[model samples]
Target: MTSCSPTLEPPSPSRIPAHHVPIIPPPPLPPGPQDLAFSPPLGSLQAPIPPPPPLPPSPPAMGTAPPHVFGLEKSQLLKEALEKAGPVPKGREDVKRLLKLRKDRFRSDLCWILFCADLPSLIQEGPQCGLVALWMAGTLLSPPSGIPLERLVQVATERGYTAQGEMFSVADMGRLAQETLDCQTELLCGGLGGPNRDLVLQHLVTGHPLLIPYDEDFNHEPCQRKGHKAHWAVSAGVLLGVQSVPSLGYTEDPELPGLFHPVPGIPCQPPLLPEEGSPGAVYLLSKQGKSWHYQLWDYNQVRDSNLQLTDFSPSRATDGRAYVVPAGGVQAGLCGQALLLRPRVSSH
Candidate 1:
């Protein structure tokens, strides 16, 4: 089991200064294949090649990751998508390939770190939300630890969690995760009912994986008032439209990168995101575009990655089950049961 949910509270007095912050948009999708010779430390997004018409659905990935969709477009595209909206999954096979890449990884060497993020059920005895998020954060900011699971144990031990021994503590979880990512974190208690999906996309575009709290029922389980259990997963990345760099300002909105414009309807009250640090803190993927595309590290597991997720709108109540959360009523906001953990910028 992964991290379970905690009883949620109201919003904090201090909110993330999202309104003032400019949502950095991803650059135009890369035109064509970039020379493998050049590396993208914080530069361009490399996309996959298209398959010839007819035989297959998704072309095989050339390397470690799958085909690219948006290249650098993460937010501008998402915002545009919010306006027009796209198709959600209808059934099993449909959900599997809906917006996910054929493979688990992205072409960027930076994302190679994601491969080390495997939080199998065998690793820990019980639910381990903090440990799961910690491993992901560590892989995101630092080089891949040659032995990831072992590395997680080592870090937990150093944090004095080994002494605690398989105990589930939110404090320990947050602290360990904070230390691993070399960043700070804040709890987004309110507005979680509607993670906006747009805001979640914006956060992902900023390269901070959102540690979200999901009531177990959302994960295809039956629940009673007393049987409220929470689960956590990191929103790592997406599989959308991406490609090789063809030219300047060429972007798309299908997968998350598109032309930039004012994103309407961002709520400040009961705001649900963390503060954006000073300008230079978020690495810019393009200097010329309206906004920058912060790189993300996607763990790519079924639980963490949305590759096989059928938990969104339209599919909210599938298989003849009712998951309708009444707005501001008794079962509102997933019963007012969600939280957003935005990664803070590290002082060190």
Candidate 2:
């Protein structure tokens, strides 16, 4: 052991180990990183941007309030849309976009405030749904030139369009529209058990509302056997080609703007849908007995309602001319019958 300690001396330079260097870490990044910037990592939690403030309590449900609730005079584009068949504005931004670009894409719910009368007053005395529908259609097409509902009902009675205050025959209604409203009427036969999809889209986009007949009772669930009571209504707006993911028998029909709540007596369903390429929802200005308002029905609801009216006959019309009793008169129901009404163009 003594001998080994004595021999411990400075050996060769290669044998000696290298000197250790003290390592120092880099300085921290600046508070804001002035020179370099980076966005937050993907899928990171971020402060949410707030949503829009809610609208005023739904504007008293369509038919509940006075005529001023429709607010037609507030927007000139709305006036032009209903009166001149001008391009409809989808939303607030769409209004500006249409005004500036003048290019339209039909991808939203179209609405026209064509009917703003007191419903209770109009249909209180009798079964005048057909006349009310015609009145709405005439007003939509003719603007300030449309005749009064009373006058229209009187004329329909005198002309035999209605019997015992009810209108049942689709053909007779078409004739009535032509003669009374001075409308160029085109009757579309739903040969395929529903409304003609092409015809519905074509007329609706051109500001021509359809006078359609459907069983009012069939709209709600718990199907009843009240033998179809054909109720007439006017389609004020139509949402066609609703964008939906073509999956296994499902749809995602976008809702119309505004807080549309369900009324007590109206039929409220989970937005009944049709096939992908079929007719979409229809917003009908309908009057059923005491309840008069806008009803939302999918294409199938309208079709089913139309189909249910197969056994419906006029309440009082005995003559063949008063009902759907033509030469080969067998198909009696107003199955998918729609009247395309256009104002008679004056040839000055």
Candidate 3:
């Protein structure tokens, strides 16, 4: 068998076609005298191609809806919640007007210091919902000293207001609010369920937040099933019956004007039923880690939650003075309990 060499000789010139013959080009160099002229081999160096000019930065999308907090869009939830709620009621319109006025005055008015977005979400590390709520209220109502939650816990523990993971008395909470917040506390009896519903509305409408101690479980006893404790939340404001709350957790939809989707949740209350009428939902802001949970609850939901306190027997009741009419005797423990916090110095 004949073996072929790996390196073969070039093709014979006579056998190659004339057009196929290789052409050796002259060196690429400028004309010059023989002694001074020099040129590198043709393929040695190359001129680097400059990258195409970077595309102009894209303009930000106008009217972009905020990212959704949940799978559903804000408009979908709002439509579903209000389909039967009828047209926006007059009371709701009035509330909207007042809230708008407050929004307009937010920068100039100290009374409107706490907007729905302004509520800091301080989570409870242990059975210290009350203390956390107190901290939120204290820090917001008074000048900001940047007091941490640990400090509030230490304060409450020293005062004997908290022990064994239980806030045993509502009266103690009132006193604690007065002492820690340096603000007068008015315990109100009505909570959208009783006769003082209008008053509670007034408190919230005027930008006063309520520290409500409720079952937190609503009718669902998730805590009892898990052997946990009760809860407290700050009621920031009541939502307009027909308006979209974008701040708490909504963004305007770019595709459709005046439409929104849930950024996780709405800033204010969830949508309400037609029968519930206008000014239907309340914004309940609670801590969940670093951020907060925004819930829009129907008036009855908040009412029933607050009223559940009536069944809670307080460990002690040193202060029984409630501003509104008491359904039970004044001595009744934790009945229709709510703390309306006003700044110590008038926000004139």
Candidate 4:
């Protein structure tokens, strides 16, 4: 009674077309027997994709730089550091020649040693500034006695440098020198100051190589330079002005015609610098007799080096007057803190 059947409205012209709208349904597989006899069904247990040949056992974690076969590449690096300082020092051409001639031998020396691409990006792993320096010095001073860096890492882990796989604490390194490197080592510079003049010479005189830390600020360090991202280099030589150093002369009798007498019981003293050039900047040597001054290496050469000869020593008194002299030519002064590393025959 309420209403007749409601009229249905026809669809609008926009609603539907004469052609049917199709859906993208996947196609069905062809039937069984043919598939089994012909090519196996796409669903059959195909060779399990072989898991990509096990991915070559994966590489040692990320921060690692590829292992380099032996060689200092020092000559090339030194040339780069010095040529930037100023007119290359007197015999740089010779050093370059040595580098070229000894290049093969140097590589042989660094060959088989493991090195990681240490960078600031790896800050979480700990600063590599000290590590790189040690790497160079240990290789140089110890001569044929260094473990691959990866192995060093493992040994450090066993020795309790367990904070991060690639990180070694100062103590960790000291022990590493003892346990793994089989040599004695000491931290020469800590915090923002350079080491004492005579101390560096003493070590060099005794055949110890120094590890110098550098940074852009050249202020607080152990890591970070503009391009350096915390850098280090091996201090291999001391540019002493004179060959032999004499001890102080003291006289019990002022009336004696001659200069003061020598003490009887003194052991030979390692030459302490004259007040003249108190702490002469160390004359860095990568190779002997090449006259490389204050040579340093940077793994990341991120910024141009600022190596002007900054006098580390101002000179001590020959008698009374201080004897200060230019330490080295245009020192790259990559040093913020310095460390002394000496290799003694391992009791082990």
Q: What TM-score, over all chains together, does every model reach?
A: 0.35, 0.49, 0.48, 0.37
What tens-digit string does per-residue lDDT give for candidate 2 at 22-76?
2221122224322333556679897544544443333234333222112234545
- Candidate 3 C-alpha lDDT tens digits along 1-348: 111112212222232222221212211222333333245557878564454544453442432211111112323543343333322222222233444554432222111111242344443444566666676666567776545555555455556556532454455667766665667667665344544565666566555767766665543221221112346666655543333342554554453333333444334433322233333333333332212333444556566655645443242233352222124432243446667777777668
Which 10-residue span in candidate 3 carries the lowest summed lDDT? 63-72
Which lDDT tens digits does candidate 4 get at residues 151-265? 5544544544432332213334555555656566654332322235455555655446665433334432223323223334455543332333354432222432211222445
What C-alpha lDDT do the candidate models reach, one value each?
A: 0.32, 0.46, 0.45, 0.35
lDDT of predicted model 2: 0.46
TM-score-superior candidate, 1 or 2: 2
Lowest summed-lDDT stretch of 10 residues in model 4?
113-122
lDDT of 1 at 261: 16
Task: Quantify how close model 2 is to the true structure by its C-alpha RMSD in Å.
Answer: 35.4
Model with the higher lDDT, candidate 2 or 4: 2
Predictions: Cα RMSD each: 20.6, 35.4, 30.0, 29.6
* Local distance difference test, candidate 4: 0.35
Best candidate, lDDT: 2
Give one clash count per candidate, in the order shown.
Answer: 24, 0, 11, 42
